[model samples]
Target: MSWQIWFVYGLVALAVLLFFSGRVRLDLTAALVIIALAVSGILTPAEAVSGFGNPLVMLIAGLFIVSEGLARTGVASAVGVKIAALGGRSERRLILLLMPVVAVLSAVMSSTGVVALFVPVVLTLAREAGLPPARLLMPLAIAALIGGMLTLIGTPPNLVVNRALIDAGRDGFAFFDFTLIGGCILLLAIGFLLTLGMRLLPQRTSAPSDDRHRRLHEFAEHYGIGDQLRSLRIQAESALVGKTVGEAAMRREHGLTVIALQRGRWLSSLNPVLVNTRLQADDVLIVVGRPETIATQTTDLRLSDQGFPHGLQRRYRESFGAAETLVVPGSPLVGKTLAQANLRARQRINVLAMRRADKPLEIDFQDTQLQSGDLLLVAGSWSDLERLTGPRTDMVLLQMPAELADRTWHANQAPWAVLITLLMLFAMATQVTSNLVAVMLAAFFMVVTRCVEMNEAYRSMNWQSLVLIAGMLPLADALAKTGGADQIVNGLSALFAGHGVYVILVGLFLLTSLLSQFISNTATTVLIAPIALNLALGLGYSPQAFMMTVAIAASTAFATPVASPVNILVLAPGQYRFSDFVKVGVPLQMLALAVTVLLVPLVFPLTRT
Candidate 1:
């Protein structure tokens, strides 16, 4: 072997160690690998940096925009609500309903975000529907892992393989390429959990339910300001449409407290309504004041009284529909109070009560500084209330009243969202346009048709994901350029000489899946894909089956919380032990392996001999 091969080998090993160490970010580690190769003269500077400009990167980014459009129009959450409704408050049935629904959602959007949004809903179901959090969460996590299998943009690994095929001078996988195999696998997964999987899950204890009818309690209990918490929408010709919260001054003249400021229905996001944000037609105001005062100003203010939740109208000792939000550890609002953090002025939610360590603090909550894990019971419109769901969110919503379910958003722009997606799929499947061009066009139409906002399109992208894939792409090029990929493939192929192609498939699946349980699935795919492709060609088999094996194995990341972000999101709330994941995940991984080995050959034949 040449010195260059030895050097590449050492660098690949070091990069793997660093990825598992968790000390450095995966993208940065990938960047280091690219720099080392470029500096060592194994790859030219242009080759080292070529990955960032790849069309696959653009395709992924454009898909993120299309997904944001789906989310903005309430299409995604509406799907969740519909499927959840099918559960009918039954514990076992809800698990059956939630698992497939979540899987389907994850097939389109980020699985991590889908799990984040549903965590609170799952917790609520456990408490009210009398289910164990563990029983529901384990399936939720596993279903999300399976969801990534169903579409072209379902997971990053699928795209990595397609890029590998394209780089090898073959056509990339079509948009619906994975649908047949992946959809079959998804049905099997759903069946597995519905039957044997739940028995393996821990029957952990459930948490207590919260007060759902206490929203107006802030106004009635504190100041006797109003008997009902009311919402009013400004009409197109309303005088309040162009005014800011401060200018409206409902508190001074109408004895009304501005609780939340909301945006238009066609727009995206459940963010808090800000005080300084100018009101638009259809902009809803969540306010607390005397019913008569609000009614008197409705006509004069040129507003439409949107009415409060059903429970709020007849309720008193309790508050209006309330949700508990947790202050995440790294949140910038960690040390600030309601007033200092400007929660009201910015997100426009009022803090009714604060609790730490399960004990309610009797001090003035508005003046009190919030620490990590502090839970605040907040009141606002259901649409404005569902905003805080992910690790990036400042306040993680824990639970919301069931009354809001009836008032939740729907799939209004669903047809447009579906049309754009289908157009992209047709372009890819038919090869009429490049994958990048197809997705970008779909993304453009999504925004022009008001399916997604401009800002949200940008936010939907996971830059680290894009950078991680871009940076790691050069490693494969370096491997092939420096003869490292050939060396590795030859050594492994010789070790299994005289063995059938099925043996190689099993080895690749096991190696990739095992590594994926510790490092990320995408990184695992990037590192192993080239070798799998090389191995197939040497054996006179087409790269088709081998590449498919690598992509599917890369997604078998069920062994640990650290395996994927979706697992970690559920860990604390599920109160699962590391052993808990392994207890169930190990068996599931074995099931996937059997399924892949049996299915891959049937789907993509290796009969090149």
Candidate 2:
């Protein structure tokens, strides 16, 4: 290989290595590759930055904005609730109902977001049904994967391939051009999964159950305690000393309901709802009613507030302060304890509580390793609080005063915004307007109307995937420009020409599918589309047919966690083991392969070599 060829080969190798390593982020890795390509003269500065401008790249970014709007407006959540209701507290019913809903949503919006939004809801429903969450969550993940193959915009891979074809002077694929085959493959996968494949899933009965009641108790202990109750004492000489809580009329006189009664080493329940409960002397009544009412009842009982220093009493009020902040990934505070982060000393914000990834914090504050998604609670004035949190991506201000850190956020949008995005997507899909202009106009309107704020629009774009697509484009061009593609195509043509186009289609699909499992989807699409086009050119077959096969196979990464980021994303939340993907994905992989082989030739005629 020449130095240029070797350079291109090294770049591809380096990109794949860094992506799978998971130590460096995918976006950063893409940026490094772009910089390397520019410095090496493999691409001009314009070409290096061109990925950010690619039509397919913009399509991905624009769809993200739309999906974020839908997510904020609670449309997705509403759909999730309906599916859960329809599933009616049964695991098998849930799989049947929710899997299709999630798959369809993912086909239009985002596979990762669809799974992220629904996985928790499914888990909650499963817990309510007393089913192992493992059984439901893995199926949801696979469904998202299957759904992404259903449209041109369903996933990044298909869009990347579509753009590659357009760039090569072929008409771009319509939104549903490949949907017939992809949808059939999806149904087949789901059918097999529900009937026979589910039996292959390993049963897991050992996961921790949710303890919502206990969590609620901890919150009440922290926030609802009144100041007057801090000083209420039952002394040896007091009348309350020998009286049982019920006999003393503490519930009636003090207007306090005993939630938990502690007597030395044991706790007694006094709730009238608990049958056959009892009260004992020296037992402390953990009351829930009110503090002012208790103070009035104890006032005639002669309680003394002396003995403890007034300064010592003041310390309780001074120990903690509050501030509102958002959680950003890779923040120093993420996955750290309150004491470890020195949250009080360095930031002067008390660790009151946290909201994380659309869920309330259930982990113990002191013990919880703050992951990337956690929103923090800090104490400070508005100005100082903003000053502290403004630079931190991990912290966003919680605007609701009455709201606890546990509430799921519901972000509503202006209806006009959704209408405008729909109009743009429709025009682009129908070819009434080119996608490049459509996305640009849509992004502009969103900014003007404040649908997606300027900063958010900038932040929301997937720059890494954009860069990966652009960076590899020039390399693919370099290959074709240097006769590298012709060399490979000629070899492939000689080897497979006598075998026929079906064999050639299968060969290209397997190669693209295998490469996509390990590399960036866009990169795989860019790398393989040109080769597929070249092979078709050399063998007198339809390049469109070959290109469509690459597109389908590129999006169909079913058998491994590393096959797609969409698969890896749910791993932690679903608590999925690595083997989970293999168990469910193997059958789907075969199904997609069968569909591609059968459908591509019929759609795009293949001639004899």
**Residue-wise C-alpha lDDT for candidate 2, range 1-609, written one tens digit per residue:** 567667766776776666555566555666787787789886788877776676656655665565444433334433445665677667678888877887887787657556644654564456445567677777777788778778878877787767777887767888888788878877887788788877866566424444222232233333433232332434445566555544665444555443333344210111111112344434344433344565565566443322223322222112212344566666776767755775534553445456666555544455577786666654432234445644455566643222121122222343545566567656654557765676667667766666667676676554555554555445555554555545654576577667777888888888777766655566678777877877787787757788888887887776555566565544544555446666676667777888889988887778644
Error (Å) of candidate 2 at residue 13 is 2.3
What is the C-alpha local distance difference test score of candidate 2?
0.59
Question: All candidates' TM-scores?
Answer: 0.52, 0.52
Each candidate: what lDDT?
Answer: 0.70, 0.59
Clashing pairs in 1: 213-319, 214-318, 214-319, 214-320, 215-319, 215-320, 216-320, 272-347
How many clashes does the backbone of model 1 have? 8
- Model 1 residue runs over 4 Å out of place are 87-95, 98-419, 425-432, 450-453, 499-505, 511-588, 596-609
